[model samples]
Target: MILSIGCSEPLTTREKGAVYGTLGGAGLGAIIGSATGNAGAGAGIGAAVGLLGGALIGDQMQQRQNQDAAVQRQLSTQQAEIERQQRELEQLRRQQAR
Candidate 1:
């Protein structure tokens, strides 16, 4: 009998941080706006501030993605090199056997 299993991709730390930060920002914005008499202006300013903060956070997530990609490329190159060396070694062994 053969069994197959599926695995879900894990969320990176940066992604997790961004998700929590967005939720926190929205909650704080609402609370701040409600506490102050100028709810409208407060909301507007909050939104702007929240948007800027979110963008900076999103930028950080993108930076992590870039770093991960660089590491993956390096690993792939190393794997390819190992495979090539193995094939060459096999060919040399076969030649000696004949």
Candidate 2:
């Protein structure tokens, strides 16, 4: 009853941040440049700077997210191991009681 499309993977926050930042920076840069009487140059410079800064920030954000995910996975593994040990201990205790 339902249809699926290609590449269901969504864009990460880092990518979104980069795109937004680039657009915002360029727009702001052009406006400021226009006041000095050079819209074309202003826009070009603005867009370039914006793109670079945006990409850098996005990359950093993605890295941080990856680190956080790794930590979470580790914690989950530890917790599971602890639970397993606890269960084993409980079984041993029961056998000793009998």
Residue-by-residue lDDT tens digits, candidate 1, 25-47: 65677678789866666666666
- For residues 1-98, could you state the per-residue lDDT of candidate 2 as single tens digits? 01113326666666666666667777887898899998777877887888788878888989999999999999999999999999999999999999
Per-candidate clashes come to: 0, 0
Task: For candidate 1, list the clashing residue pairs, or say none.
Answer: none
Lowest-scoring 10 consecutive residues by lDDT in candidate 2? 1-10
List the candidate 2 regions with Cα displacement exceeding 4 Å.
1-8
Model 1: weakest 10-residue lDDT segment is 1-10
Candidate 2 Cα RMSD (Å): 5.3
The global C-alpha lDDT for each of the candidates, from Candidate 1 onward, is: 0.69, 0.79
The alpha-carbon root-mean-square deviation between model 1 and the true structure, to one decimal in Å, is 8.9
